[model samples]
Target: MTEHAPTTYLLAGGGTAGHVNPLLAVADALRAREPEASVLVLGTKEGLEARLVPERGYELLIVDKVPFPRRPNAAAARFPLVWRRAVAQVRRHIRDRDVDVVVGFGGYASAPAYVAARREGIPYVVHEANARPGLANVLGARRAARVGVTFAGTPLRGGEVVGMPLRREIVELDRAALRDEAATTFGLDASRPVLLVFGGSLGARRLNDTLAESWPAIVGAGWQILHAAGERNELVDSAHPDYRIVPYLDRMDLAFALADAVVARSGAATVSELTALGIPAVYVPYAVGNGEQALNAASAVAAGAARLIPDAEFTPDRVRGEVVPLLADPETLGALRAAAEASAPAARAGTAAVVAQIDEALGRSAR
Candidate 1:
């Protein structure tokens, strides 16, 4: 009954919804382009992909793996055995399923997919969303036939700076409807400009505490807040009349779409989505790691998209100084919004070529 050619494509990304959801969006787009193409998700059993991928009506090939431990000694000791087992699982999937293309979307699941794709002599590509590429994606890009980047500054070799792939569902939301919806769904006051605050799932405690301490001033600015305080911050006065605090933003697309101006930590995915939507934000990148968050925010700033306020200066006084000015000046906020682009990640033209490459490689490897 289907008019499209039948093909199998392997979609890989996981650990967090940030990575996994984008992969799902890309795969969904592929289906829209060719309804007959079948998608199999290659993901770690331990990650959210296990729940999310299956929920989207795709078959999930689970692999047992863990990320390369950031901390050493005791954690590092388990790496060798885990690596061996992961490679074995990936090899088995390719051999058994006749997989077509292995696309790496960053994170641990891509590790095994990278190994399996190389071993099978298949065509695999890496889609790096961060300004500074992550470990798994860094290695994966070396052998990838093509590399796709969401940000302009990613160090992916042989990569084209394709904007981050977001879902059509997200892209289609009516902005006014979203803001009005978020006001009710999150129990926020429409009279005040809503400064939607969030830091992904499991939440950010430090951000939560700082927001709680600064809530009075934030309210005094004629602004209401929908803060996603981490679940651990149970003691904070989230139920106050002016504040709408939640454990998570179940509808992030709507939240970001509706927010007037947002305050949050800058993650690569956040930067991509905000840029894609043209949302203005004040970012407090985590004061840790290789300072990638700061680097990521810096790129957005270069584009006039956002402002990075150092975490050290996150006190009420400093927060009010940066925020009140930006909030009061619609001109500045408008500039930030103008930075969001509808075409930063445009690849619809080369999409069929990518899909064909995926199909040929996956089919050959499956053979």
Candidate 2:
């Protein structure tokens, strides 16, 4: 029998969960498809990938964090030398590891990885997780062998809507099957519908404050609350039996399983997961960045799969008037859930679609 050389894949991205999580999802898919294939991660020492990539058991390749200079300054003066060094580092990794292709999820490391892969004549793929593309993705898209976007209207060169690659737990979760256990895990009544609220890992002060002032109204409306306040949050948990508050959600699958509806930030992953799971939600777009959060939730809102409230407008009064009434109305919630399910087909295919892109890129390389 003849022996075949194992293919090597270099996935580059990391800074936040938005980038790292998707990169990990594709990596997992690649490994599952070809156990003997080499799966490597390129990331900066300062980014979240420093911890997470290693924790996920993938080999982490280090790259210098070089921010694109917005203005002519000292860092800008030194940008060329630094950028050249970063690209050279990635090129060397590609050559030494015999990398067949590169897949980037768009972050600091991706910018240079894209350049390196291009210089080395190896195919590279780009995955943009936001409705508004980032600088790295914007540049990479111009030459990427294939470009994937999480939302339909994201303007990127050759971009196709492939949805967001999600965590295995989120992808495989069966909310109805897990509801009773999830209810027990959160100490809530399985017989009652639960409202889940969160603001990502750090928690959102806006959500915490609004809930603090308006939770009584929610509880009074016959809904249970499971709020994952950020770890830095100091909002004291009220001792109300129906209202449960935690610093962070280590078990998001359980939280999703218990949630009949959600009130949370519209991060790409959050929006993707909620819609993918068919959970109706009210999105409070974080009032920072390039207003991408609002854009992220737009499709869902348009489809009646979710509702949007600006961060500045997510006040206690708004929650009392709008959110409370929505919770009290089961018919509307059911419709929202159905809309979410209807909008989920594309999202559910994200992992497979990204992996297929990778496979096609590899096939082209072989040819």
Candidate 3:
């Protein structure tokens, strides 16, 4: 009997947390499943991966970021040469490292990784974190061995809804058990209903401004708030006893434990985490991109797990008129919670699904 050699993986993606986080989740999964496997991360030096990948104990491979030109200009004319350099860099790494699979999560790093993998006759996989796929993933999906998407409606050639691969902390979090500790950690009473407000890392100006204006009313209505005002937030603390405002939160699981409801931007990770945990949310999709944020939250909303407020209409008046009333109604909140629980997929297997696809491809290649 002969033992098979361990698989070698080259995971590519990184720029924002959306890409880096999912990449890390898959990396972590791969490592856990096959402890002896060699897992490498390919990313640009300037990306968050440079810091995060090494911290997470994976080898970080550097590649130059080549952004595709949308408009015809000098940069557009120079794109082909720059893009070629990136592909060549990736191809060299693939050859030298003897990578068995190239998994991409879509970033400036992924396009070249995809092209390189194809040229090298290596199996490749793609994971798109948005309902609307990005340019890199769109190009890569055509030839990928497997393509997984965070949302059901993502328009990719071979896309399957795999949910989002969540952090281990979130996947294992028992919110009910941690409520008292979480409430204490955030300096709020566990007995009261908590409304969690956040707008990503840098914070949402509109969300912060509206919540700041409406906090007095929110607190007056007997709800506590745990608001992460972002690192560069301009919203001043109103000094309410029940309201806790911080620039950022390192422990999101704690916040989720105490939160009865959430007000946040509907980024892929945020929506996935909230629904996975069965936490009801009022989504304020960022007013940018191809409206992907809104699309990300669509299923949650349609399933009655969440509500959506257009960016332009997310004002103090709307908060007072709409959000306040919803917060005040326990029955409505209960309904939302139930819906959230129903809407949330069995997310524990998201990474496994991706890994399964890779394994399937490997088996086929071997045959």
Model 2 whole-model lDDT (C-alpha atoms) = 0.94
lDDT of 1 by residue, 1-367 (tens): 3233476678788988668877887788777866777778899878889898889888899888777877888758988888878888888888787776788888888977988888977678788767788899888888887677766677878777666676665556566766777677777765567788887676766677677677877788778887887676664555577788777776886676558888888887777666656677889988877787887777778777788888887777777777877777878788787774533334222333344445444443211
What is candidate 3's lDDT per residue for 195-275, written digit by digit as tens?
999998899999888887788888878899999999999876657778888999999999999999999999999999999
Report clashes for each candidate as comma-separated counts: 3, 0, 0
Q: Give lDDT per model, in order.
A: 0.74, 0.94, 0.90
Error (Å) of candidate 1 at residue 265 is: 1.2
Worst 10 residues of 3 by lDDT: 358-367
Show pairs that collide, candidate 3: none
TM-score of each: 0.86, 0.97, 0.96
Regions of candidate 3 where Cα sits further than 4 Å from its true position:
1-3, 364-367
Q: Rank the candidates by TM-score, best first.
A: 2, 3, 1
Per-model C-alpha RMSD: 4.0, 2.0, 2.0
